[model samples]
Target: MSPALALEDLAVERGGRRLLHGLNLTLMPGQAAVLTGPNGAGKTSLLRTIAGLQRPAAGRVRCQPDAIAYAGHADGVKSALTVSENLRFWAAVFGGDQIAPALAAMDLSALGDRLAGRLSAGQRRRLGLARLAVTGRPVWVLDEPTVSLDSRSADLFRAMLAAHLAGGGAAIIATHLDLGIEALRLELSEFAAPRDAAPLSGFDAAFA
Candidate 1:
């Protein structure tokens, strides 16, 4: 079987300047890779490049078409919609019909009828993560997925991720905190652009 995701000498550029270069990695089914680095190291850039949200300046990123589910810093939930409605919309958009299962996995059944806007930060994050299950994509690309989540919510996320991996799904996550899941660590600093180069600008730099 083909690898779930592959990168060959991948280079990422932002603001007309290169941030990451010469990155090569492959993730097979049921595997995970965690990205780690300090500010300006290009962790987010790498993830975005892999997610196809940003164009690479050089090299290639190869993955099965439409096989990726991405969850970024933004929750991507409509505040006016109820929790269940939000999941339903995503299910329709992603060509999946697993909203109920996703909600249950995220422990969000009780909040199904509540408006998303009224959810606390942790609740909102959980709802955002539930989209992954609804999509039923084989590969997940998440950036700081645990942000705003409390300890319990974080544990829930870990469990969900473990289940995904167990089911032959792969994940690439960029986070500073631990998820307590087995994953290979990919330090972006190893592929960071030269220091003499211009520093990364904007919010991407904050997370690096």
Candidate 2:
């Protein structure tokens, strides 16, 4: 089978400084990928480029747009909406009824009627993760997915991820903590950032 996604010599630059360069990575169905690096290491920027939220300065990104789901640090939840309402909206966007199961998996089933704005930080993150499950996309690009999640919630998130992989889905996660999920490792330095650079596009070559 063809790879789910491929990044060939992808490069990215931001604020006139190089964030990533010559970064090559491949994600296959059922496999998980982790972008492990310290702050300012370009992990989020790399994921953003793959998700088409940002453009590479030089190389190219190739993937099936409909088969990918991208989530950033911001859950993007409407505080005024109820849990069920928030997921209902997402189901509309992804065109499916998978949100119910996602909500249950994230432990949000009981909070379906609760306003998202009133949710705790961890609760919000769980709702955000529920989208990944409901989208049923082949690849998931997540940035700090477990950031505000409490220990139990974080564990639940990891379990959901394992189930996702078992179902032939893949993930590319930019996180500071080890989710303990089986995954390939990719470091931004492997892409070779330019010294004293800005503008976020200098690392586009890795996307080729």
Candidate 3:
């Protein structure tokens, strides 16, 4: 079987300046990769490029269509929607029907009826992550997925990721904190552009 995701000599740029170049990696079923680097090292850029949210400057990123479910630094929860409502909406968008399972997996069953805006930061983060379970996609691209999560919630996330991999799913996570899950580490700094590269400015600096 083919790998779930592949990047070949891929290059990403921000502010008309290259941030990452000549990057190559492959993720197979039941595998995960954790991207680590200082801020502006292109970790987010790589994930965004893979998720098809941003175009790469060169080379290729290959994956099955609709295979990626991405969770960015910001929680994608609707403040007005209840926990259950948020999960249900995502399930419908992603062609999944796993709301109950997702809620249970994220340890959010008890908060089902609570409006998202009323939840604490950790709870909101959990709800954001629950969307991944409902996506039913084989490939996950998450940026700082554990941010704002307490130790227990982080542990829960590790367990969820492990289960997903065991079930033949793959994940690419960009996080500064240790995930407590077995995954190959990719240091984004190694792929950084040369010091002589043009400095990012204006709108491009936003991505940096």
Candidate 4:
């Protein structure tokens, strides 16, 4: 079978700094890769590149269009909407019909009717992860997925990820917490580039 995702000599730049270069990876169905690096090491930049939210200065990201479901550091939830409605909205956007399973996978069924703004940080994070399940995509690109999750919610995430892999999905996770699952441990230090000063920021950076 073909690989679920591939990075060919992937070079990524952020804030005028070349963060990653000549990085290569291949993730097959049912496999996972954990990105490990300290702050400023470009882990988020790499994942954002894979998610098509950023452009690499060079190299290639190989995956089917719409194959990736990305969950970044931000919860990306609509605070005014109820938990269930948030998932339904994402499902509609992604053309998926499995909102119920997404809710159950995140242990969110009980909180379905509650407004997202009323949820605790952990609950909000779970709601963010649930969005991934509703995408019906084969590849999950997650950055800090367990950020605010408590033990139970974290376990729910782990279980959900296991199920995704068992069903022939792929995952690329950047996390410091131990998920207790066997995954290819990928470190980004070797591919790092040092910066002389803090890189660009705000409109000056964006418009440059």
lDDT of 3 by residue, 12-37 (tens): 88667788888899999998999988
List pairs with backbone clashes in candidate 4. none
lDDT by candidate, in order shown: 0.89, 0.83, 0.89, 0.89
Instruction: Estimate the overall C-alpha local distance difference test score of candidate 4.
Output: 0.89
Worst 10 residues of 4 by lDDT: 196-205
Ranking by TM-score: 3, 1, 4, 2
Q: How many steric overlaps are in each model, in order?
A: 0, 28, 1, 0
Residues 55-86, candidate 4: write the lDDT tens digits.
Answer: 77678999988899999988889999999999
- Kindly provide the TM-score of model 2 when superposed on the true structure, using C-alpha atoms: 0.91
Superposed Cα RMSD, model 4: 2.8
Per-residue lDDT of model 1, residues 1-208, tens digit only: 8999999998887766778888999999999999988977777777888889877778999999999999999999999999999999999998877688888888999999999999998999999999999997999999999999988888889999999999999999998887878899988888887756664465444554
Candidate 3 worst ten-residue window by lDDT: 199-208
Cα lDDT for residue 61, model 2? Answer: 76
Q: Which is better, 2 or 3, measured by TM-score?
A: 3
- TM agreement with the true structure for every prediction: 0.92, 0.91, 0.93, 0.92
Q: Taking the tens digit of each residue's C-alpha lDDT, what string does model 2 give over 1-208?
A: 8788888888776655677877777788889888877788888778888888878866877777688799897897999899998898888888887677898899999999999999988899899889787776889889989899889999999899898888888889988778887899887666757676444434443452
Residue 60's lDDT within candidate 1 is 94
State residue 63's C-alpha deviation in candidate 1, in Å. 0.5
List candidate 4 stretches off by more than 4 Å: 194-208
Better of 3 and 4 by TM-score: 3
Taking every candidate in turn, the Cα RMSD to the unseen true structure, in Å, is 3.7, 3.7, 2.5, 2.8
